[model samples]
Target: MWYYTLNGQQAGPVSQAELAQMLNGSLPSDTLVWKEGMADWLPAQDVDAFRNIEATPPSQTNGSNPYAAPNSIVDENIKLSGTDEIPATPIPLDIGFCISKSWKTTIACFGAIFLTWFVYILITSIVGGVLSTIGTAIDGPVAVAPITEGMTQQAPFLPSHNQSINQQTGTGAIIAGILNNIFTMFLGLGLTLIGLNLLRGKDTNLGQLFGQSGTKLFRLIGASILYGLMVGLGLVFFIVPGIYLGMRFMFYQTVIVDKDLGVIDSLKYSSSLTRDNKWRLFFLFIINCFIVLAGALALIVGLIWALPVAWLTLLVAYLYLHDGERSLAA
Candidate 1:
């Protein structure tokens, strides 16, 4: 039993959520009439003009459908989306289910990035010092400068590098940089874990989310690599295609968490969810990701604000989509 006041007349017994959607144009078949509180939905006998508010609560009584719906032939008008006939809900930026509680998760994700950078810098600095000591022997100590490069012909016995680091250029340095990339890849794992926990609306602590624990933690590392690859691939087809791809694969984290799918399956499922709702999802994505666009337009300065806002909107979209799916299933 539900009650609501529409226009000036009071009504009772309407399923609130269902009726709200009907009133909001979701139920295409229902034509609403007007009464006092419900200027939108009134019976033919009670049609009136201006609605008046009643300070008093309406009778605490439930009512049945005065006129039963006819058992007439109904049209099977709903359009199908994909081969499996899955009906994923549209996730607009303005929709409900997003939370401010997600900021911690966002922080955690970014923290992984920062932590990786710091660690890589530290390791390279240490390794550079050792090589600099070895290089000093041949140069005869004339105010020795650090061998910023990992290894070169100058230190052929040590692994030779073909890349530049700090002030050193060699094969060894490039190998160190490669190792740093690997470190960052691990950090990306941390970000994926935090993101998944955030999607679940869980109390996410960055350290805890990616703690050295089990296979799930390592799987996050793989997902992060896949995510980066997908993002790059998404950009390969042109701008609009890239944007669409981003939105289509937005559910990868959720797919991994709730569905326990592999990286490829998560990407596949996320893509499939957008089958027929591409345009709708694209338009809504504009709203949710407008901050990102704005930041891009602003160049560097806008990035500070844009990144966080875009992330929040992303969280919002994820929640809206998942909640809607749950509700529809229920």
Candidate 2:
């Protein structure tokens, strides 16, 4: 089967013979075509299989081909402008395509992504452990009292050493959690940017994971707070609304990192990009959850592969919806 672009929209999964017939003296030489296993779309003339299919003469009228398959516009909302301008409307989300491409991407660049993730995990673990140790030192040790017959028979009211230890540990845990969350937000922005670069067939490295700073970082943090609050409030008020808003604004982080938009603008852009695709996004989320669960069941080692695939899948979907598949290619 094969697919081709017609009038800036994808069309057909037609047979080879049909494709040849459609191209012979009908479509232009420069029409883009793609099929499974191809890294990216290519001009009809550039693909050997279609080179034999003579293109319509330039002198002839460039009218629509009667034999051409009907346009299979992926998303009616998207209007391709044939340039680098980002689409203001949402594009189609093919769950299968996203997953397959993401898996391939993960395999292709596993070393870089895995190394980056491993470093992040190591840093967070070290920080958490240090804080916990400090808390333990501050609390000291608890002594256990031997059980006596009289003590067992009577109800004794006294402050427990366990309570004091817990209080001190809790305070340290609170501080650790705040610091961890702040670091995660910044690192997460870098990770999203890395994922985007990987999807676009660009080179990436460990340095990419720490490239975030300045106004973009601040904007991402701001957007994260607003996004969390809205979804948190919605979830608090109504379960359904919470789920809806979660899906709608899920792309805010990517928007801020990718487009450099302000906090509110990023949230609004994400909401717009997700319109008409909430159900699809929900289904994708469910699929990723299962993937992560499966990874966890595999003694947690599988997460090294599963997590990157899941994140790349999301980045692929973002690029597809934001600028069409063309943006996915270098």
Count backbone overlaps in model 2: 0
Please, what is the TM-score per model?
0.42, 0.67
Residue-by-residue lDDT tens digits, candidate 2, 157-262 = 2235555556655755567666667777777888888888888878878787788876887887788888889889989986878889999899988987887777
Q: Among these predicted structures, which one has the highest TM-score?
A: 2
- Where does candidate 2 clash, by residue pair? none
- Over 4 Å off in model 1, which ranges? 1-175, 185-201, 212-240, 277-306, 325-330
Q: Which lDDT value does model 2 have at 37?
A: 57
Badly placed stretches (over 4 Å) of model 2 are 1-89, 131-172
Score each candidate by Cα lDDT.
0.46, 0.73
